[model samples]
Target: AQSVTQPDIHITVSEGASLELRCNYSYGATPYLFWYVQSPGQGLQLLLKYFSGDTLVQGIKGFEAEFKRSQSSFNLRKPSVHWSDAAEYFCAVGAFNQAGTALIFGKGTTLSVSS
Candidate 1:
């Protein structure tokens, strides 16, 4: 079985401060990991993903994540936080094998930006 864990259920950060959202996963084989952000009443948008290649992958919206295979973690980071960055972040994992293509998502972490 595969799963994603977001230790922080909610996070509040002052504007301009750096941000780090934690995520951990458990999978039998190499995993396809992704981070998605969804604003209030909006569709989820992909923040970043790791299939293969460099462990550190840059994503949209000034975000990046590093995939650590040994630790089974893929944590998202942003150098600076903005008001618009407030949203629900989800960490997901996918499989491309015969089992089927479906993403298993974490409960999600809500980010609050303070002025």
Candidate 2:
């Protein structure tokens, strides 16, 4: 079984401040990692993913993450956050099986950005 956990339920940051959101996963084999952002009353948009190769992956909106195999963590980070960046962030893990494959999402962390 594969699972993902996002420790932060909510986070508040001022505009232009650095941000970091924690994520952890449990999987039998190497899992595909992904981060998505969802605005209120909107669907999720992919932020980034880690399939293979580089441990550090970059994404849209100036976001990036590092895959740590030992820690079983893939934490999201941004040097500076904007007010527009306020949204709910989800950490997900993708699993492959004969039946099918799907993403297992975390509870999500709501980000509140203030000016």
Candidate 3:
């Protein structure tokens, strides 16, 4: 079965520090990869995605992700972190065969920005 895993359950980064949230997926074929962020009591917001074409995909809020087929990973990165960027980050995988089915999400990584 296809699944996503976030190695870090929680990360604490100082304000303006670099951030990297790891995401790894297990699937027979290359599946759709997505990064989502959710604030407290808020809905999930799309950060970036890797469908095809480019191995490195840019996303909203100074975020970018690189798709490494060899690693089966689509890791999200940001050069500088912000306090507002603190949220629960989710790595998700969607199958091409199952169009209507919901994506498989990782447990989630909670980001805490420290001053």
lDDT values for all models: 0.97, 0.96, 0.95
Q: lDDT: which candidate is best?
A: 1
Report the lDDT tens digits of candidate 3 across residue range 1-115: 9999999999999999999999999999878999999999999999998999989999999999999999999999999999999999999999977559789999999999999
The candidate with the higher TM-score, 1 or 2, is 1
Which of the two candidates, 2 or 3, achieves a greater TM-score against the reference?
3
Residue-pair clashes per prediction, in order, are: 0, 0, 0
69-103 in candidate 2: lDDT tens per residue? 99999999999999999999999999866557889
Q: Output the lDDT of residue 96, model 3.
A: 74
Candidates arranged by TM-score, highest first:
3, 1, 2
Error of 3 at 73 (Å): 0.6
Summarize candidate 1's per-residue lDDT along 1-115 as a digit string, tens digits.
Answer: 9999999999999999999999999999999999999999999999999999999999999999999999999999999999999999999999879667899999999999999
Question: How far out, in Å, is residue 18 in model 2?
Answer: 0.5
Candidate 1, residue 56: CA error in Å?
0.2
Instruction: Name the TM-score of candidate 1.
Output: 0.97
Query: What C-alpha RMSD separates each model from the true structure?
Result: 1.1, 1.1, 0.8
Models 1 onward score TM values of 0.97, 0.96, 0.97
Candidate 1 vs candidate 2: the lDDT winner is 1
